[model samples]
Target: MAKRCVPVTVRWSDMDAFGHVNNVQVLRLLEEVRVHAFEDLRDHGGPSLLESGVVVARHEVEYLAPLVWRLAPVPTDIWITAVGGASFEVGYEIYDAVDGAAGGGGGGPAAGGERTVYVRAATTCVAYDLATGAARRLSATEREVLESWTDEPVPFRRRSR
Candidate 1:
């Protein structure tokens, strides 16, 4: 599936005492991406991931490096990792804004510049019926729409800190 790359605004309140984005703020960024990606579904009268009945079942975030505050927006790339009967997983990669282009940093850091990965994260969300208060199976169209954004499988494993 095609990945969605978005330029996210970094507000002053998003930073911590160290001038880097706070850990919680990073999750908020991911949430923003999720909402954006699912907007189409809601627009078409389908279940809304944010306003409708979708719920975050789990979130796994791996912080690779701190992202410093910059006037330019941070580039975040998001894709669907998996789609199930009633739930789906979204994957995200937040890249350091080097070269001033969307995900433009190439190779590794050079002597004069550095390109780094700020965060790698994933979220699992389940669809639910608001009135019934129970999980709802994904409609055919819903599944198809989500599958269109699916990427290669991501292994879920822990690494030593």
Candidate 2:
């Protein structure tokens, strides 16, 4: 799997009265993961997606377990799910390494370790032309970069028929 694993720090403020990371804050964590991945891609022959203007068209998130605050960063796995002319889909899994050990950074699960998934999510992102303020088709370089990280769709538990 060509996924990107990012270690995201959980802030104390991210917790809610119930003593777990707030549901809304989970989205923020996902954003952090994406930002890290985008930066990495840029350094490795990929387009500077942030600078070029990518917008979130939609998001689907499913919470499986409550994520509690911890000293160690949470391991988040993200990958490209689909690539379209002007849009793309990204999938994510927020999880904990087995025995609370932070997984190896970069990609994939920890060596011979299981993961306790906290959330599953997918985001639809559209490439935008900042000057024109309109959606734009992905460039050849951008498409190649995205395809290199492409993986299976998010295994969402619930889906509409």
Q: Judged by lDDT, which candidate is best?
A: 2
Candidate 2 lDDT score at position 106: 45
Candidate 2 lDDT at 1 equals: 70
TM-score versus the correct structure, for each prediction: 0.81, 0.91
By TM-score, how accurate is candidate 1? Answer: 0.81
What is candidate 1's lDDT per residue for 40-114, written digit by digit as tens? 556665556665578889988988888888767888888889999999988888886566544555666555875
| Winner by TM-score | 2
Clashing pairs in 1: none
Evaluate model 1: give its lDDT. 0.79
**Superposed Cα deviation of residue 97, candidate 2 (Å):** 1.7
Q: Between which residue pairs do clashes occur in model 2?
A: none
lDDT per residue for candidate 2 within 123-147, as digits (tens), equals 9999999989999999999999999
